[model samples]
Target: MGLIVQKYGGTSVGTVERIMRVADRIIEYKNAGNDMVVVVSAMGKSTDVLIEMARQIAPNPSAREMDMLLTTGEQVSIALLAMALQQKGYDAVSLTGWQAGIATESVHGKARIQEVDTARIRSELQRGRIVIVAGFQGISEKGEITTLGRGGSDTTAVALAGSLRADKCEIFTDVSGVYTADPRVVPMAQKLDSISYDEMLELAILGAGVLHPRSVEAAKKYKVKLVVRSSFSQEEGTCVEEAADMETGRVVSGVAHDEDIAKITVVGMPARVGTLSRLFNTLAGAQINVDIIIQSSYDAAVTNISFTVSSDDLVRTLDTLAAYQEALGFDKVEHESGLAKVSIVGAGMITNPGVAAEMFQQLAEQDISIKMVSTSDIKVSCVIPAEQTSLAVRTLHTAFGLDVAEQAVVHGI
Candidate 1:
């Protein structure tokens, strides 16, 4: 029998009925003659509720205590899932991150997995028991409980699968698999059956949200085969692996868009070596992530640097730049919120000519202006007004033939 590791997201095990459904699925895998290990996120909305509760008590709760509190959500899930499986007549046992020997660094909010001691899991499996693990949380060397940050459960599952050397790591979420676009916005977007790790990484970063980027990175590094499937259905889902041949390549795999973006432009700066460094250093110090940077070389001894950051950082970023404006000798600092980033991700685009031209032509035909442009080996992204995001996404989806024969409908699980 081969060992298999499966991870269920918060929506997959959201309720008592859903937990029982998940238990039934695990039992089926066990009956199929494969050793099963399951990792689960907190029940649906539990983490958010806890966070809201903590906010109610204190505007800024201590990170250590917050970690201690949020980690309990997943603890509740694994324990309940184990009990459900046992009630269904399967040999099952649940273990928290500490009990399962997930050793992590001292970082409380975004702890990285140092190592996973698989002794207990192996022993339980050898005794013909299905092992359940609480995802997203680990214990430090000093016995302090720590939590991996948002989407940490995905990373936890991949790490466990790598350490256990499982045959496959399956991530069960609310959706069936990765799609060509956000189906809610583009109703005709189709789900992909397979995708390359590199393409998947671009999609995740571009807001596809099928799998977390960190999880995909770990899976790629460890050479673990990953499947993104729905917990409610048995249909085949998307498989992510290393690209083997050009035959599987598609011209445009998907279109991704992000609405939580703001643009900051340092305009008319005196052309100098240290100007860019000082500006970016200030932003870095404020813990703001700057994305899609474009700089114009100086002809009149003035350079313009434009970049995108999260909308929430707009105020602080502008303030920080203004604080250093006089010292940096910039003419002015301009900021705009309510901007969107639309990225077209595909592996075949690198060798295929006319892809960029086609995207630009389509946007132009629709009267959608491109504010900024960024390109990589496998993707091209453009910034546009937030109001035009849906139009751009739909236009690109149609231009690239990502639309399905039938319309797609969105429903919550």
Candidate 2:
């Protein structure tokens, strides 16, 4: 029998009863003769509760301390899950990230894994025991506790599967599978049977949230197969692999939207050699991420550069830029909130023409004004008013022939 690694998100093991159910699923797999390794996130809303408590204790907590506190969330999941399996008469063991040999960079709250020592995991599997390891956390080379930022647990599972050379990796979440759009938003969003690594990576990065981009990157690097399925269902999940079926069906596989966007514009900047580099490097030094940048000629002598960042980062971004104002050689800056970004992603776009044009046309037809734009071989993103996000996504989804069954649905906007 093949070795398999599985990861259950917070919602999957949100309650003690759910943990027992997961244990049963694990037993079924083990009974089938496959070696099992399971990775799990903190239980539902526990991480948020922890963060809220930390905020109450101190408005601004140290990232190191935050990492220390946050890592415990997954520790709880692993231990409780292990107990559930053991109570069910299955031999199971729980290990934290460090005990499982997950090593990471020294960075706190956003560490990247450096290596995985499979000795302990392999030993457990050899004994016919199911191993439950904590996800989203690892010890730094300096022995500091660290986290992999948002969606780190997904990376943890995929990385372990790769290191173990497991036959496959399965990501069990609340949703049954990956969809063309968020099914909650676009009720007719189609579930993809299989998606290519490139397409899935784009969708994940574009804000699908079904799987994290880091996990997809690891899967691609190690050539590991990934399946995203429902934790509570027997339905087959979406397969993420080398090639997808997009070549035959829809030219646009999905429309993705992010409502946490905020826009910042550095006005009247001299269009000199080091202007762009200096400005962005400052943001990078501040660890602020920038997305969907556009530079325009405010005048020949000065250009206006605008970009987007998370609303949470908007204040930090502005403060960082203000600190470097003279160095960046910009006249003034402006900021705007209540913004969003929406995009269409598919591998077929690489060989297809006018996809971006069609997307812009779809948004235009909905009277949605595009503020900024970014395009790649497989995707195109536009920033627009947050209120129009749902309309934009549904409009583009239907326009791309992605929801043929809902062809008669009214354009509600």
Candidate 2, residue 105: Cα displacement in angstroms equals 1.5
In the order shown, the candidates' Cα RMSDs to the true structure are: 2.8, 3.3
**True-structure lDDT of candidate 1:** 0.89
What's the lDDT for all of these models? 0.89, 0.90
| Candidate 2: tens digits of C-alpha lDDT, residues 171-217 | 99888788888887888888888888998898888888889989999
lDDT tens digits, residue span 293-403, model 1? 988976869899999998867887888888888888888988888899999999989899989999999999999999999999889999999999999999999999888
TM for candidate 2 is 0.95
> After superposition, which runs of candidate 1 have C-alpha atoms over 4 Å from their true positions?
105-108, 140-144, 267-270, 274-287, 297-302, 312-333, 409-412
The deviation in Å at residue 132 for candidate 1 is 1.7
For TM-score, the strongest prediction is 2
Stretches of candidate 2 off by over 4 Å are: 244-247, 404-413
Residue 252, model 1: Cα distance from true site in angstroms: 0.5
